[model samples]
Target: MTLVLDKLGLARNGEVHLDGVSASFERGSLTTVLGRTLAGKTTLLRAIAGLQPIDSGRMERQGCEFGLLPPWRRDVAMVYQQFINYPHLSVFDNVAFPLRQRGVPDAEARSRTETALGMVGLSDFRARAPTALSGGQQQRVALARALVRRADILLLDEPLVNLDYKLREQLREEFRGLLTSQSDGIVIYNTTEPAEAMMLGDRIVVMHHGRILQAGSPKEVFERPANVAVAGIVNDPPMTILHGRLEDGRVTFGNDVGFPAPKHMDELSRGSYRFGIRATEILPSETGGVIGRVEFSEVSGSETFVHVVTPLGEAVMQLEGVHHVLTGSQMRLSFRPERLFAFNADGEGELVRAPTTGEY
Candidate 1:
């Protein structure tokens, strides 16, 4: 079964919420809608759930018009960023609420609720109220509630965003197995974090400025981003874009920085191109050609992300372990030419050449 969206568009108060967005979602697959805030990820999910009305669009599920149905009539379930649960009901009752509303038999409802709670590791908390649970446990209850009904379509809008980092990581690790188990339904998970999107998605739908930017497998999108915009969105620290020129078999960034073009870019007839390299690819070296001054540094967990200003442009380097880099200190940094991504210097910055090496 397939859910297809055609030219979906929505606007409010002169602001475009969705700009001709279109994509196909297949059952049994999880598609992560990835984008920054106000990128219309939630708007897209709301449209699918019939909770948000679109000014122009056609939604078809299994060849039948789907947008015309009311929210209650759609066989869809949604979990929001917040830990939303029934305060008055026990965990078991909260999960069984939908089934009860549908007049499902008490025996079958209990069985389904029990199974859902167990799937989320919440079976032991079935007798407790949502208020008595931790943030993570409450979110799990929300998830179990969503799963208990076995809805045809499942939408999760940053469901783990409210939790602490450790809890988010813990829940995210378990989410893939739990979500993929719903192989008979269409699951769409929305997230602003590129890491979460890449980790959880079977396929990724990249969105920006209310438009569909790119849609493909996580590996495909990461290895070969559609354009500069996609490259910026998919990378955690954002890829460093340097305005450069390619001529005479050499790529040059500024007058002093030049290197022989990698083999992947040999076929390109380029005058000017934008070069991209990930932060992790840039390394500090004593004999490096690029001279940069440390602008600032951020230490995340065991890794340090150093921001530096160079003649070419500002760049970020991801170094393993903790390193205290002083601001305004001169540092030499280098990156392999073969790791660079080349893109057209004009228009949307279309990709000219991707790195030959698959590792990024």
Candidate 2:
């Protein structure tokens, strides 16, 4: 289904929740609403599902108006961050609840329920009670229930937040495979973490302060954020942005360090600017442009984030595989010119691509 959120506005207790959110989800793709807490990700999803009444704008699916339709009336299914299941219902019954309510034949409902359970790897738990399952298993059961409906629009509100890292990683791949292969439906997922959005979304909407700040592919947003807000909030540890000046064809930092300006930035005269680089892209070497001491280091599986306090400021470096980054050890960091982003005084960003740059 082509799900479109048209200028949606909502409020609760006299406080604004959704401030004119307008976006569309194309069929056969996953659109991730990426933002932090209280950024209106949940509110936008509820509004699209018709659970939260919009004060102004309307929800449209496949050219049909949904302002007057209730949750059941819309061909939609939602899996919340919280795992919700009927305690008294068996796994089979829970998965088949929607089909039963729609009065589907017992044989067809059974077939569909079993298929959904199998997709979520819960086929063997059909006869078990919801409470008898582990938290991860129960969340999978809720996902199975949502899938059994075969709704045109599938809404997942941070569905994997409660799962352990290993399981969440496992399910992220599963969700992308299942949802992206569909040519007749779409999945709208909300996430507060950039890593989650990068994994699950074909398209990502960067939301902030109850508004969508930017929308693009994961690579586009990650490599080239729209503004300072997008740069600050999209990453796990966030990007390290240093305010500096564009002077004499070079961008000058706090220390006596400078780098040649990119093509797009050449037009502007020497003035105030902001330069940023992601933690992962900060190349560390024995002798580099910026120097700092290792303040902290953490290892997770094959990845390591080493915090360094440079003359400019403190920044985290994401290194692949585990490295013995001893604390208090001096470190030197350098970055490719194209890997850095240059923003004007007004906060508008210029996306820098390797061997080329563009003013966005």
Candidate 3:
């Protein structure tokens, strides 16, 4: 089955929620809708489920218009960010509720409920109430409920966001297998996390300010972000954007930092350009030319993300292992000229050239 959205737009009280959003969803494929909070991820999903009205747009499923259909008449199931399961219902009954409501045979409901529970690793907890289960277990129950319906469209709106870090990671690993089992349905998962989106999605749709920024495979969007907004969204610490000039076979940032332009940029005309570099690409070195003062540092897992104020602009350096640097301390950094992503200096900041990949 194919679900196509054309020119989806929604505005409320003079504030736009979704602006001219358009995309196609295919069955057996999982699309992750990625954006920050209030980016309209939930609004889009609600519109698909017929819970929210659109100001303008058209939705077709297999050439049939379904945008105007009532929520119950649509073959859709949604899982929210919160653990939305019935406290009074046992895990088994909670999962079977949808099938029971549809008047499926008792025997068939039992079989489908058990299968869905088993897929989410909640079979052992089938007799337990939702209130008696852990957060992860409760979420599994919610997921099983959605899965049992086997709706034509499954929408998950940041369902794992409320769990703790370790639980989120564990469930994320399990979700890919569980969701993919619904091969006949179109799955759309929403998230604010770039890593989760990249890890779980077959295709990713990036949204910003209610607009679709870019949509493609994780690698395509990561390697060649459509614009500065996309680059900011896809990277964890966000790519460091530097306004620089490429002139006389040399690339210069600020007043003192300069290097010979890499061969990949040889074909381009020398002028003003915006350069982007990943935090991981910048390294601390004793002989490094670019010196910056550390503004702040964050240590996540074994990696340290150091924010620095350099002459060119603020840049973040992602370092392996934890290194404690005092705020205002001087740190010398270095990066290869070839690793920079070149973008047009125009207002839109379109990508001009991306660094060569796979060699490093």
lDDT of each: 0.92, 0.83, 0.91
Tens digit of lDDT per residue, candidate 1, span 1-360?
A: 899999999999999999999999998999999999999999999999998999998999977899999999889999998878889999999999999999999999999888999988888999999999999889889988898888999999999887778878887888898887854799999999899999999999999999999999999999999999999999989999999998999999888888898888899996999999999889888884699999999999999999999999999999999999999999998877889999899999988799864544
Clash pairs detected, candidate 1? none
RMSD of each: 1.4, 2.9, 1.3
Model 2, 255-343: lDDT tens digits are 67778876656666787777777787788876647889999999978899999998888888899998988999999988655566776
Instruction: Report the candidate with higher lDDT, 1 versus 3.
Output: 1
lDDT of 2: 0.83
TM match of model 1 to true structure: 0.97
For each candidate, give its TM-score against the true structure: 0.97, 0.90, 0.97
Give the per-residue Cα lDDT of candidate 1 at 120: 80
Q: What is the lDDT of residue 205 in candidate 3?
A: 99
Question: Native-vs-model 3 lDDT?
Answer: 0.91
Q: Which runs of model 3 end up more than 4 angstroms from their true locations? A: none
Clashing pairs in 3: none
Clashes of 2: 0
Off by over 4 Å in 1: 357-360
- Alpha carbon RMSD to native, model 3: 1.3
